[model samples]
Target chain A: MSDKKISKIKIGIINLKTNNLYSIYNAIKNIGYNVSIVETNTKYLNYDFLILPGVGSYAKGMKNITENNFNKRLIDFILPGEKKILGICLGMQLLFENSNEFKMTKGLGLIKGKVKKFKFIQKTIIPHIGWNSVVLNNKMNYFKSSLINKKFYFVHSYVCEPADINYCGTKTFYGNKYFCSSIIQKNIIGTQFHPEKSGKAGINLLKSLLK
Target chain B: MRFIRIIPKLDIKNGQLIKGINLEGLRVLGNPFEFAKNYYESGADEILYLDNVATLYGTNNLSKFVSKTVKNIFIPVTVGGGIRNIKDVEMMLSSGADRICINSSAIDDINIIKKTSRIYGSSTICSIIEVVKIKNKYLITKSNGRDIVNKDPLEWAKKLEQFGTGEIILTCVNHEGLRNGFDIPLINKISRNIKVPVIAHGGAGNFQQVLEVIKKTKISGVAIASLFHYGLVPKFKFKKNRIGNFNYLDRVKNLNIKHTNNLKKLKLFLKSNNINVR
Candidate 1:
């Protein structure tokens, strides 16, 4: 913790050309951090934190990652350091091993998990869009103590299912299914919901990352 | 389950906020970004802006406004009106709108819904279903109530659900701006027939009217324009006086709609009534 504070903190937001690119940039800037918008062509990985924000299907999102070689650059950037990465919405799905959206698409595999669509009975709505509270899995006492169950804006039909239960950071319920809303594995953190869009609670999450 | 969303509907025309009765008699309201931020601070769950004249403009003219507001407001924003094809949807989404509402375009080509839902994901798309009651039967209408489709709304809703629409905005054209109340029977029928969440829109005279509609229907949210647009000026109390009646031009100035009855009171009212609100 002391060393983390001693080193100068640099935040880089990878530009995936998602819908919320500029909004995320402004939100982080408003939070009092001098953030950098790293374009796809640039290979600058000298940041303490990286945010991968995306919206749209897994196939298209993964295609952008592969076409632009963002996957290779991202993996190389965080492999040998105390650096952390945060993935929001479709960005979170991209961190998993593979996804079943549209077709079987491979993810970054930073965390061992599979992305699957929400399955429920006939009356249950797909895309579980809106503000839903997420419960911190008690297995991780750090999250349990700091981030109790709180509501966050979620707009997705797909969620991450980590291979190991220990990787599950937070869980949420939609319809009759309880799925992993977030994953915390060492320095990598991913949230199925958009923290930048979740208002105060969301801001708090981003601020926590800064600390 | 999560709380029901309370969305403030801002109708935009020619890059200015406007309000009207039954989607007619357009009256300027205020700046779109200011109103959106005020609503967000007051605890609005989400914001919806419909480009009232997007069809005539042949573009989502509200993209700049959406981008500007998304910087200050952290809540999700949905933009609608004149979304004709995949490119239009892409433009709006890329402009910082969390979701895109398709009405006239989806009605024109059902395949547009399929194509968008496939690429942008179902959650990114919301289908706005505006209906007009004709001889006790609810029929789907498009182009801002100018064109009526000879198809059952329930059938259309099912088709949209199958096409993977994230949700449905059921707006009653007759009840819109009339302030009578929501079309309860119409909302109930559509909400029950579809699997996706329904956003009950139009004809919300007060919090009570919203609660009444929520109580009977399976809607996941309520979208209000006149209720929020008119601010806290009581409906009958102001009209009864007739002393401060102003025309369309001075309506935004003369009326105290800007600073009156905010999102906080509305949320409290809904919560007090046992309606789950964010």
Candidate 2:
């Protein structure tokens, strides 16, 4: 008669300074998810959920992740069992094969495709800063049903697209809107904005993830 | 994703946004607050409100001015000028400034960088060095380069990074009014040495200069004075590097241009071609 499906969720945050994990950190904690922070050097990946925040140059950030052996450890933690990892901004870009920020830096190949710089259609700013709403190709449990077309904060020069189109759950815009934004490739799901700075839509999205 | 900042520098006399042609070319544009709001809505990351009154008065405490700018801009706002002591720093942060940019004091006491950074999480304080070359050697200056200090700009910059400041905003004193371009070597030096992001300010007369900065130096962002202020857009050329492919350019030429609203067209052009010519 007892279903262990109703278990407490444990979240772990990467203690890096990119502010990539910041908004989601605040969002998860505010929603009462048990969260802890661990550095790449330390072994603390054992959690129900993992978060990685991103900022700055992709080539440099990836180097830090690789040089410190943080990359291999991340792949090890995610491939086994049912685990959910959220990569914000540059963190989202890192999930791809390579990025073109400073140069063609290698990224985690958990998802397919390379992160490319935004080329505007109209004179849309290259980085695509500010609020833009996302359109869902199909629906997922993580997207709040009432929150469709809700605007969220986006502040990055590059965007993430899954190697496969099946991974793209929802797509947002800047100049050219393409690829995986809110990806649902099985257990892994990620967003490109900070929930802490993103007002209500981000909060709602976080609520869905926690639920 | 890349978040580029288009910051408007407001030369504050007492506590107002003043715009001018050269450093000496000062005139009141409008209320600093009104201008900050307009720019924020138009997509400016933050505002840099520098005090012009410190030279007039012997004191360099700009606490009152920082308060006014923070009150005006709902987003993160940074204030510089006359920030000498811990008390002044405390006053600025409490008054609602997202960051405090230190100019003169930073050159004299790099330890203040460690002190303030320890107290305010590094991101809150920016060590600004205004440099001008005397003979062959670059001399660090205070009071808007009125008081020259005996220190190499590059060495002092590296020392400040050891002090643990979050970021450095370096302005080329020689290039300040010239509008030729950002001192690429200096940006490369500071950005290479500092663990935090370095923002190049002062010269950026054209798009080539901006591309030059990104190509020559691995800086996080660039701060414009004459370029953005004069309503000129930078046209860039892309170059492939070992680290990443960046937009690089050499000469800077000033020209009149208009801002366009075509994200689709811009993306198409960026994809089809490597160069961005305005």
Candidate 3:
């Protein structure tokens, strides 16, 4: 997309009250797009793209989303699938059916998946923190080939397992396990890593995917 | 494979970037934002902002600094110093800090770690453990090494891990700023005892020292200040403002430190040694 075309794209970042929305906001704004922080009162349908950025526990995130009535608003906004919504880190996990973090918590269920904690393995740390390479699924060309094997910042203990393999957009290896790092189902997309915090490579990925 | 992160730790005092030896004798550098932007543009994996006097003064002024810096730099930024409560954590996070590092506050009340970690998830909270060795015993210090705690460094690290800390930044007070090398034995012990990722800070004088630390120990990241900052001293222009000590900036040219000023060079050097770096 041209710079003018990209600048015309309006992006809304949903504030779940549990995320550092400024980084993502700054990132999208740095990309020269019209971006705004979507609070509980903000209109969801105003923007062409919506980003669900979150940090914190699965239960707490869901509580905020449901309590603020964003659950219904988000489902309604994306019902037609013309607009796109991207979820990052905990936000990504919320798109699954349910998560076993702390306790069984029901998520947005926009996609087919379940979130589970990483099993204790020798020589591997919990809350897998640091930069890890994301091996993009070659069969799915949703992400640019340059993103393949690119390292993105990740800091989470839970992993999302989609019910079907077709939905997996990328896979990353941590410890001895390879889990889904990103998922794509029609207009809905989720990334386990913080692309906003992943430096230049991340910025390029966001520009390509969101633009 | 997991790529080890190379984080550039910028010490800020009175809104200016500062560096000290053994966590003392502070020297004023240029603007923190300029240094941070340079690091980001040079392919730094992450940026760490540590308020030099926040704990001593009982205040956190880095929120505005962090907000301004994050506007241009897109890497993961971790803000530390004077994070006494969840409100402070909230403030830093709201200001665009990806993670908040706590040392003095966590030392004051151990429960703060558990509370913040539970609320924000363990991945968002990083505990900084500054170590000072005395009489052959390693002790953890707080308030930027002003106060020493009567606890073993290894034990404290284990406790931090148990309390749900996402990561641990282990700073060796004796080895810091000297740039001789990292305390490999201490880093290896702490990392081996904890399940969470540990970032080794201090005593990184050159690229070889960094390579040694990562190769000798299981540290997930290396936080360097003097090596990276001193190498880039000539690049930044400092304003004629009185804040902290500026004598070191003038004498930096004569220091003759053997270091790679560019982060990409360090990454390339690491990669040549068969270490996974991004």
Candidate 4:
């Protein structure tokens, strides 16, 4: 797509009341795209892309989405497969079938996966805070060559495990184990890391995918 | 593999970026937004804003600046100083802060860490433990080393981690702004004992010290001030009418500081030394 065409694409960030949506909003806006914070009541069809941004517990994330009826709205919006959706951090985890955090909570089930806490071992941090490198999957080819082995900001205890290996776009190593960092299933995309907070590389990744 | 994050810590006081020696005698730098933008552009893994006077003033005044900085910079921003309750944490997060660093409040009430961490996940809460060495004992201090807490530094760090703090920012009061080096022994002890990531702050004079700290200790990141701040002093044209003392800005211009202003160069230096850095 041309720069002008990319600029005209309307992006609606789904507000789950998880955490700050401004970082992703500002990031997408900085990329010259028309973006807005859309709630469950907002018209999802108005935008070409819908971003589910979240940072909190999995149970609370699902509760807010179900209570606010975002789950229904999101399902309808992305069911056509023509429109794209992006899930960030806990937002990404909520896209799975279910999460083992706190209690066994049902997710949106857009992707065949489950969220589980990292098993603690020697020399492994619980939350897995700070910047870690994401080794992009070669078979996916969703990310550009430059993003291969690029470091993205990650801060979370639980990780998403896709049933099919093909859906795993990127994997990062921590706690002596590798977990899915990004998922790409047709028009659906999710990143466990905060690409908005990944600085220049992050902005570039968003531009490449969203554009 | 985990990349050691190089964070540029901007100490803010009364809406101006300031740096002090041993956490005292604050000197105003140029605009913090400009500095943050520059650091973000230069590949700083994260930007940390510590409101130097927030504890004394009873409220954090960095929300406006945090909101403004996050508009252009696409990186994790951590806001510290004077975060007492859940409301303060919410305000900072709403203002675009990815993480809230608490020092005085955590010292005043250790349970505040548990409460905030439970509400906002442990990863969002970063506990800042400012340490001062007196009579060969490392004691934890609050409010930027203005008040001394009777708790041991290592024990306090362990307590903070147990209370659900995701990260610990260990700031050495004696080595801050001196541009000498980091307290390696203290950093290693705290980081080795705690399960959460530890970010070493204060006493970063050059790239070698940063490299030394990371190599010697298990620190996830290094929060630098003078080494990077002084190198950029010559780059910015500070307005004379700004708040705080601008006199230090002029002196730092000619100051022979052996440091690289560019973050990429520091990363390259670390990379050359086989240290994984982003």
Per-prediction TM-score to the true structure, in the order listed:
0.92, 0.52, 0.96, 0.95
Q: Tell me, by TM-score, which candidate is best.
A: 3
Q: In candidate 4, list every pair of residues with a backbone clash.
A: none
Interface RMSD of 3: 0.9
Better of 1 and 3 by lDDT: 3
Q: Please list the residue runs of candidate 4 whose C-alpha ends up more than 4 Å from where it truly belongs after superposition.
A: A43-45, B252-262
Off by over 4 Å in 1: A1-8, A139-146, B232-259
Residue B210, model 4, lDDT: 91
Q: Single out the weakest 10-residue window by summed lDDT for candidate 2 chain B.
A: B244-253
1 or 2, which is superior by TM-score? 1
DockQ of each: 0.71, 0.04, 0.86, 0.76
lDDT of each: 0.82, 0.62, 0.88, 0.87
Candidate with top DockQ is 3
Which is the winner by DockQ between candidate 3 and candidate 4?
A: 3
Worst 10 residues of 4 chain B by lDDT: B253-262
| Candidate 2 lDDT, A1-211, residue by residue in tens | 1223423677777755433333355456666566777677865477778887665457656766776788888888888748888876777777889877646778888888888866656434333444556778675655757348665665565677666877777887555555456677777776765544455556667767756
Error of 2 at A97 (Å): 34
State the lDDT of candidate 4 residue by residue for B1-278, as single tens digits.
45688999999987878999999999887778878888998889899999988898798899999999999988899999889898999889988999999999888889999988877788999999999999999998888889998899988888898899989999999999998999999999998998889999999988898989998898888999888887777777667457778778778767755544657778889999988777
Residue B97 CA error for candidate 3 (Å)? 0.2
- Model 4: residue B66 alpha-carbon error in angstroms: 0.7
The Cα RMSD in angstroms, rounded to one decimal, for candidate 1 relative to the true structure is 4.2
- Candidate 3: segments with Cα more than 4 A from true spot: A1-5, B252-262
* TM-score leaderboard ranking: 3, 4, 1, 2
